[model samples]
Target: MTSSRSETAYQRAVAAFKNPTLDLLHRRYAPFVVSVLSVMFTAERPTVPISDAHVEVGTFVEELRAAGYDLDERTLPNGTGRDICRSWARVGWLVPQITDGVELYRLSAQAVGALEVAGRAGGGRAKVSRSRVRTLLESVEQLTQSAETDPALRLARLRDERAALDAEIALIEAAGDELDPIDDDQLLEDTENVLHLSRELPADFVRVAESINAMQRDVIAELRRDERPAGEVLREYLHRGEHVMEATPEGRAFAGALKLIGDPEHIDHLTDQLQALLGKSFAHLMTPEQRGELRAIAKRVEQGVQEVLQAQRRASHVITTQVRTHDPIRDREVDELLRSVMSGLQAWVPDSRAGDRIDPLRSLPTAGVRHLRQTVSDPRPPTAPAPLRDPGEQAEFVDADTRAWGGPNYAELEAYLAGLEAESFDLAAAFAGIGDAETRRPADLLGLLEIAHRNGLVESAEVSVVEALRPDGTARRFAFGAVTARTLKVESHD
Candidate 1:
């Protein structure tokens, strides 16, 4: 009630606006955050994990920088869109949760709410239904009747609700299971309203978290100004922290909301209702962001409230800095040094132990690693590869017989062709002499010529009279049946 107390309370409330969360969302990263949230809406799930967004966020950051957005120098190369999202989580707009060992992000209830408000940003008026008024009117009536204190009024209101319920039940029974369906327009309007609420949740939480933080900061500032003893200041800090939670409007409402959000059954019911609404034909009335918010609403709210609680708890610290009061290592070393100096003073004089400073590190003796030479294999030595065995037994066939070994090999054909390499063609006797006629058969004669022809050694062949040495190894003239010539022309590949 005092002026000082009122000023302090006002300052705490103002701290909510001081938080950088709202600034980042609505100012610096507004376009990026909105784009991200909008993209997440395209997914069937509420969470937008980094796995699905590394490339997407990278590209977005690059494009934004190109468009002359004021991004940090380091962020341009590495793409800090993810870091920007993390900042939102730090401020309670997004819940940074680890599930399945992966850090995932979901829009907090506060973020959803902000999006709803911002949904109309840079755009035209929002589309609210005519039935939205009807829904709000009915909601106000229910809230007012539920809060009635007079016994007579409460009883009359309860009786009316029961009568309406009974009438609805009678109609359903009278219809023989053919219940009247809800009007499509009303359903569409309600669906849109639900979507709107889903959007508002995240934004609402942002306000709550910011307020809690502001109140926390105010508590610390007050304690810092307190001139009481250290113990008294700590106790006062604890007391003020507790009082704020109980007396502050933001604190009271946030505590209640956190409880409701954390309730498993409440979350399940909200999720189920949203899913059911989305499944309806009327779901098309909602925007992409609204649909995404509905899908992730339960999870975001649950985790986001927990994170907000953590931030508030951090603000409850007595001194807020451990380094200010003590240091275990430093104290022990100082105690030892004091004892040593005092003992020296008692034994001799203060001048004996006194010096500019004793460099503890300097007198500590040398430390070095010695490497001893040992017989170790040379790691960089060049080594030859193991000789590979041939593929072994390559396939061989001649087009004439379609059988293996039905042709002369390169060696046999090479020698036979070298003699005719100087001539176009010769009598068949020349080929006959190349082999032993006494042991050779007709197939041998045909196979030798086939091998030569296949290797591109033959150009043309004809039946002609020619003098030749017989295979019998005797000097005798014979009429050769066929003569062939080697191909004198070569084809160029290139």
Candidate 2:
């Protein structure tokens, strides 16, 4: 290679390694970061509530410290998990978001990329496997066939594929009763290849979503700046917003993925195939985590797609709304006023001294009124406070009686709910599972209802009864529509 070309290539390599994704992999605590992230985020969960994440991270730090890891302030951050997470956000490894008024932490595209790299390194697979080579060959052949302009060549290729299919079908029919299934080795190779490819989808989806977000922010910033004509800005942003999936290489890959598995049928087909694969004897060779990942692949893809779609919709909505509500004149006036104030401050700062005192205005300038009407009502007591009742006349009640009449035992109920392992269960069943008599009262039932509502439980149209015994030894059956609590899997660093 020429000297100039060599220099150019070296510069490009340097630039590539300098990105946040590579920086994350090259950091001193890379393994720690990647391992914690992998444990906290999974296919079933992509976002964690900030508070839970902070607490989990804090616990992990303390555990590690107890295990004698040097986590000094100089080597590793010494503050709480909240501080660590905040540092990550500042550095673009974690993105903090608010969904439905709850603060959540999501892995950034760069962090996702770093985690992918770490996962691939730990997978212990050869860089080039038989299945991977076969996939590449098939892809190249398909591409060549599609690119062929000559009718004769295309027809020949089609005829060859048809003949091969027919031969395979004939062979299968002839050996129907004595057919040999694929060996475990080949099945394992193919499954691993599928997993390697499937695992890449999350990173790609995150990258695409982040790209859309960046574009949205850029569009908004440009609009607020009022530097360009409204017509031009609107047209440009509208087109970009509508076709955001074509704007970047990652976006195009996302578009391709959407085309491949956008349909519910395609996703169902994928799930069915995974189930069939797991049913095979070769599946025993795979680890439990691998099997779980395969089972949840469809759900992961569906959720990822939904997230990207939501991001796109939000971007489009924000752009359209900004355009619709945009007032260029008002914006310009505000901008000018801010500039004037800043210019005055800049001019005054040079002549000002730190110790100089200035009068402070404590309140806003009053609006003067010439006439005022004063209205007053008679301060007489209304009906003499209904004569105080005698303490003797009040019904005597003990602590136990008051407790029975009080609200539900929310803390105890919450602890019970947390201890359950089921993904979902009927309200009646959960109530029945309570072993403590005090926890099975009517108040506890009401507490369960409140907890369920807070957790967004599903209510059924069919009625379900939960019988409760009060402290007074009286039993009462309360009838309400059935409710189901669907427990979400908590992603923790434990």
lDDT of each: 0.60, 0.85
Cα error, residue 476 of model 1, in Å, equals: 99
Cα lDDT of model 2 by residue, 97-203, tens digit: 87778999999989988988888889775557789999999999989998999999999989999999999999999998899988898888888888888888887
Tell me how many residue pairs clash in candidate 2: 0
Error of 1 at 120 (Å): 3.5
Number of the top lDDT candidate: 2
How many clashes does each candidate structure show, in the order listed? 11, 0
Candidate 1 Cα outliers beyond 4 Å, as residue runs: 1-58, 64-114, 122-124, 128-131, 146-149, 215-226, 240-249, 259-261, 284-289, 312-494
TM-score of structure candidate 2: 0.70
Lowest summed lDDT across 10 adjacent residues in model 2 is found at: 485-494
| Candidate 1: C-alpha lDDT | 0.60
TM for candidate 1 is 0.47
| Total residue pair clashes for candidate 1 | 11
